[model samples]
Structure formats: C-alpha cells, structure tokens
Target chain A: MTSSVTASLPRPSPFHLLLAFGSGGLLTLMVDFNGLVGLYATPFYSSWVAHGTGIVAALAFLALLRLRPEAGAGGAKPAAPLWAYLGGVSGALTVILTSTAVNSPLALSGTLALGLAGQVVFSLAADRWGLLGMPVRIPLLRDFAALALIAAGSVIIIFGRGA
Target chain B: MIEAILIATLAGVLVSLSRQINGRLAVSTTPLVASFWNHVVGFAVLTAIGLVIGALWPAGAFSAPWYAYLGGTIGVIFVASGSWLIARIGAINTAMLVIGGQMVFGVALDLVRGAEGHVLASALGVALIIAGAALTQRRR
Candidate 1:
C-alpha cells in the first residue's frame, strides 16, 4: 500500500536498484506503447480520452492504496518550487505528441528511437546546466562515450527493425 | 518521417522535464499526492485543449480496448518510481538505467509479437545501451 514494501527496507542493494530503475523504464514504455496502439485503433478515442481514462485508473489505484492504513510511510521532503507542480502539463504534452508521432509513418521503434535521442540530450543538458533545479554534474570523457554508445544502440534498434 | 521525428523529439524533452519536476515534487510531497497533481493538471490541460477545439470526446470512444486506457495508470507508477529513484541515483544515472531497461523491454515485446524486425541489430543496440548504462555508473 505504501507505494512499495521496498520503501521500508534498508537501502537497496545494487541488484535492487537495477531492478527498480529498469522496471520503471519498462513500465513507462509499455504504457506509451499501449496508449499509442489504443489511440490508433479507435478513431473516436482521442489521445485526450485515452490519457484521461488512464488518469482515472491511477486515481482509483491510489484510492485503493489509501484504504489500506498501513501504506503511508513516505515522508515528504522539503518543499519544492511551484514549477515542480507543473510536471503534469508537460506529461500531457508528452502523451499527445508521442501518440500523434507514433500514429504517423515513423512507427513505434522509430519514434521511440528519436525520443530516446532527445531524452539523452535533454538529460545530459539537465545534468550539465542544472536545469530544472537538478544538480549540476561535470560529465566525464567516459560519460560522453557512454552517451555516444547509447545513441548508436538506439539507432541500430530503430533502423534494424527493417520496417 | 521528419515530422514524426520532430514530434517524438519534442515529446521526449517534455517527458524528461516532467520527470524532473515530478521528482522534485515527490521530495516535498508523498509520491501519491505528487502523482495525483500531475494527472489532475495534465487532465485539465488536455480538457482545455479539447474545449478550444470544441470536442472533448470523439464518437465511438467506448470501442477502444481496455488496455489502451492503462497508460495513465502506468504513467502514475513511472512518475512515482522515477521520482524515488532519481533522488537516490541522480538524474543521469537514473535516466540511463531507465533507457536501458525500456529498450530491452521493447525488444522483448517485438520478439514476442513476432514483428519482422531485425533481431541482430536490436540485440546489438540493447547491448550498447546496457554498456553505456554501466559505464555511466558513478565510480565510487
């Protein structure tokens, strides 16, 4: 109920961390794919409708969690900026834009590949410039190399689809 | 193709930005509360757009599969978990891990669906992504 039972455990081991991070990524992509597929399949259901429905589901889940009194252990940290609260707007934009693009000739893998490129670029920039109040990190040479590898890998995955 | 690329790229940026914002918000509020606000605001924004265009729900909306409506639910989890993970592992590290995991899962999905994609190429890409993620891990 409290988001995760893992939350109360000791600091996660490396394996636990890996599982959490990877699972989060996988879940995100699955949702994206599902939403896109649904949007394309039903002309009557706009991206808005699909997204709105998903929100309803999430709220329902949250409500169920709240019914469990044992599930509320996440202590709130210090207050964040008002901008932090605006994430939902950007999230809506992501859903709409992605749904539209994927429905186009770009296809799923291709659209995902391009999106990955953008994600990597924006993530690196965020770290480098401390944008969005994230901590600044001076990327190492290896970091650059890593980014390049990721980019190449994504391209291969997209073009390799041979569609 | 070009338009798709542009839209995808923009969407990617928005996704990253949204994740960052949600991460910070989670720090101040519980992840559930943060997630709720995210959906509430997102729904509001989309409703506003639908209003501007004069229609919130297109006809035949009831016909879409139940799974399609799960994106928002999945998204709530992504934001909540991402918010938690990013705080622990820093943004870049978290991003790398997520990307790596997502690519692997995507490839698996394609394979399972028997999509006629290039398996070898996707394998290589997944490998590179994993390697990149490992390399980016901060040297303790």
Candidate 2:
C-alpha cells in the first residue's frame, strides 16, 4: 500500500490504471454481493464476522508486505487528521446495511442499483467540496447531466417491472 | 421494503465517503496502511455494535464456508484500490468507473443466480448510466 508513495513516483500506464480500477470495482462487487449471500447462509446472523475475516486476511497481507525491504522505505508521511480514520466506520455501516438490504424484499440487484445511485450523488458532492481532504474538482453542467442520467437509469432499474 | 432500500442507498453514500477518506489517507501513506486503519476501526465498530446487540459472534458462524469468511480480504482489495484510484482520478470519475464495473459484473451474477430483474428496464438503466459516466469522464 505504501509502495506508491515515493519521491520518484513513476506514472502508471493507462492500461495498468484501468486494470487496477477495474479490479477494485470487481472486488467491491464480490465483497458486497457474495459477502451478503455467504453470511446469511451461516447459522450466526452476525455480519461482523465477514468484516473480521477480511481484517485477518488484510493484516496477513500487510505483515507479509512489510517483510519486503522497500515496503516503508519511501518514508512517506504519517496519517492525516483523526477524522480520516473514520472511513472504516462508514464502511462497517455499509456492510451492515447491505446485509439487511440484501435480505429484504428489495432484492440484490435493486439494492445494488440504489446504492450506485447514492454513490453517484455522494461522489458529486465530495468532489465538488473536496470533502475528506480530497482534491477539489467541481462538476460542470455536462457532469450534472450525466449524473442525472445515471440516476434516472438506476431508478428505472430498481422500479421498472419485468419487461 | 422501502426502508431497506433507503438504508442501502445511504450505505452507498457511506461507502463513497469511506473510499474518499481512505484514498486521501493513502496519498500520504501506503494503500495498505490506509486500508489497515480502516479495517481496524471498522472491526472495532462492528464489535461494539455486536456487543450492544448482545451477540458479537453469531451462533454457528463457524459453520460458514471458508470462502464466506474471505469477505474482509476482498474488502481490503476494494478499499486499497479505491484509495489508490481516487487520488489519480477525480472522485466522480472513480465512482463512475467503479459503479460501471459493478453494474457489469453484478448483472452477470444476477443472471447466473436466476434472480428476477427488470430486464429491459435494467438494460436501459445500464445504458443511461454508462452514457452518463462517459459524459462525466470528459470533465476530468
């Protein structure tokens, strides 16, 4: 994780960046969709266990990565404000909410569509305001129009009958 | 039903915020470090929530498949990648791409599971979203 924070940061090729982003998206999908189905199959109704297991896996990976001489050699700065650390809390809530939503009559795809719409709206605001210490990038009219279309699409996907 | 859907929507907002926060942290530290703090805080919060509910460990959760237990690991990957991408690309672009990816893979999974979907409506929705993403991508 810290490997990318170096002085001589090499620009990743477009292909690599796309691949990375694509993998991130797919992994997120699996975590949400599979995690829900898998956790519900268990006798224990605790969704925390799912998140706990991921922590275990991630810690192991971090431990292994740290063994590499270059892992933290970049000497990158430490963390930002304490509020930044709360990202995980938001994430935990997402897992719990997703678990409940998936089990509800709204079903998986519908729930996912709603989530996507929410993300689009939220991302617009975050980018516009530079929330959470992110770089500010205001959305233009085209961007707003595009987001509206996406929101409309999501509404149709979630509410349109079988057709 | 509507309430659950609302929760899911709210979850999306939280999810986006989490990714942005994690990504901002990653700019200073490694993505792993960013993800580490996230999982630790998340796990602690979940534990606290569970304790309040009087059941931190669900009964018979051990019976779950070895794979089900791997959600956290997959989650790590997602967070790490999102954290890495949000800085390079703007938040909206990153969100668009990630959601695009999710929609594509999600539809495939739904078809495999024989889940009842809106079909034509979903297709239109997907099309519009993709187009929207493309338009938004042009800004940054």
Candidate 3:
C-alpha cells in the first residue's frame, strides 16, 4: 500500500516567538561586545571592516540561499513592490547614520529607541504599500504590550549597569 | 538611564515595523535584499554625515588596527545570517537562538578579557531578556 503525504499550513507558535526574542537579545549583546572590541582596538578599522564584511557575508548568504532553497521554508512571498526594498535599505542606513551623528553608542538606550521608530515607520509603509513580505494583521493591543516588554528589557541591559 | 530608554524605544519601533513589513513581504527576499541594502545605504549615509561633520576622515580613520576591521566583517556576517534565520524560523525563534549563542560567546570572551563584572551582568541580563521574550511568544 502507498502512503499519502499532506503539507499542513504553517501556524504561529508561541515557542517560536519566545525563541525569536531570546535570540534577538543574545544577538544584540553579541553585537555590543563586538562594538566594544572595536572601540578599544581602532574605531575606523571597525567601520571599514564591518562594511567589507557585510558585502562578503551578504554574497555568501545569497549563495547559500541559492544552494539551499529549503532555508526559506516558512517565509511568505513578497506582497509589496520592489520599492519597499529600497525603503528598508534607506531606513537601515538612516538608523546607522543617526546613531553615529549623535555620538551615541550603539548600545545606548536612546539609539535603540530611534532605531525602533525607524523600523516602525518602514513597516507601516510596507504594510500600506504591500511592500516586503510583511503579513497583514490587525495589530491588536497585545502586540504593543509585547513590544513594550521587549523595549524595556533592551533598555535595561544597554543603559543599566548590566552592559 | 535616559540613553537606555531611547535605545529601547527605538528598538521597539523597529521590531513593530519589522512585523508590519514582514506581513507585507512574508517572503524571504525582502529581508535578504534589505540586509544587503542596509550596508550600502549605511555606508553612504555615514560617509555623508562624516563629511558634513568634518569627522569623515578622522585621524584614526585609516590608522585603526587591522583587527578592528576584521571584527566588523564578522558582525556583518552575523547580521545577515541572523536575518535569514529570522525569515526561516520566525523572528522570535531566530532572535532567541542568536541571543543565546551570543551570550555564550560574549561571556566567554569577556571573561578572557578580565571583565568579570560585565560578564556577570551580561549573564543576568540575558536571562531576563529571554524570559521577557518568552512571555511574548504566540500561544498555540
């Protein structure tokens, strides 16, 4: 007898969200360390190296994407036009420039706040224009509550005695 | 304290916005492109800002140690990988795993550097962060 296989739709799992936040915190901390290391070693070098590395790493990632199509398994398709991509790029650039211009450390609480604002604006635009692969949801109050907690934790570590 | 508050607020905004964008561009291409584009735009923006502020070619710009640059490259890789993973496993899971991994590595590195205090605080901070993230997880 032959067995039949069915592909089920992906459902949002609480565990996944927890994992994302946990991972995001860890990554942020790691980036912080890297920044510290650069601060002590050589500031300019750090920027140059980071830029160079980004290019090489991004290419590598693209290669990997080509090699392993399964890596993007659960991700949805892009809904917005290509212009959203430009918007995201601009937003990222703006955050970095603003951080540097203000002489605020990357781990600073204020910088993080600015970054979040930028992201929100970009997201809203993408949602409105159907750009990127963003999902369309009502964004209930609970969503804001969750985000508040995340922001609080991030601030505590960056500005508190912890860092 | 004020600085921390600002950063947290910015991060929150970014996360919220990312969610919205994620909805519109549920596919992986947006993030993939965004990651690369972030660098290009970042370089241009920084360069322009530096020039305007007369800090574009600071004394240490070209004289910084080689290792400093190397570390940046590594960071770029991490960010890209992390973004890709976020698309794959959902933002929450990827963020958690990356954070956990970073904590392990960061603590070890700091200990080697003789920064015991920072190591301790970082460890504790990571715990709290992870816990908070857990609370936000979507319910099945």
Lowest summed-lDDT stretch of 10 residues in model 1 chain B? B55-64
Query: What is the C-alpha local distance difference test score of each model?
Result: 0.69, 0.69, 0.46
The true-versus-predicted C-alpha distance at residue B53 of model 3, in Å, is: 5.6
Clashes by residue pair, model 1: A2-A71
Overall local distance difference test of candidate 1: 0.69
The residue-level lDDT of candidate 3 at B85 comes to 46
- TM-score, candidate 2, first chain: 0.62
| TM-score-based ranking | 1, 2, 3
Give candidate 2's TM-score: 0.77
Give the per-residue lDDT digits (tens) of candidate 3, residues A1-163.
Answer: 1112111112235655544434444454535644654465434334534654666666677676673322433545524455433434433443444445346444444564455454545443443343445332333344445445554544444444334
lDDT of candidate 1 over B67-126, digit per residue (tens): 656665676676677777755655665666777677677788788789898888998999
- Candidate that beats the other on TM-score, 2 or 3, i.e. the better one: 2
lDDT (0-100) at residue A161 of candidate 1? 75
Off by over 4 Å in 2: A1-46, A67-79, A99-114, A159-163, B1-8, B136-140
For the candidates in turn, chain A alone yields TM-scores of 0.64, 0.62, 0.54
lDDT tens digits, residues B22-138, model 2?
887788777777787788898789788777876665555566556656666777777888888788766776776666555555555666777886777778877886676566442
Per-model TM-score on C-alpha atoms:
0.80, 0.77, 0.57
Q: What is the clash count for each candidate, in the order shown?
A: 1, 6, 52
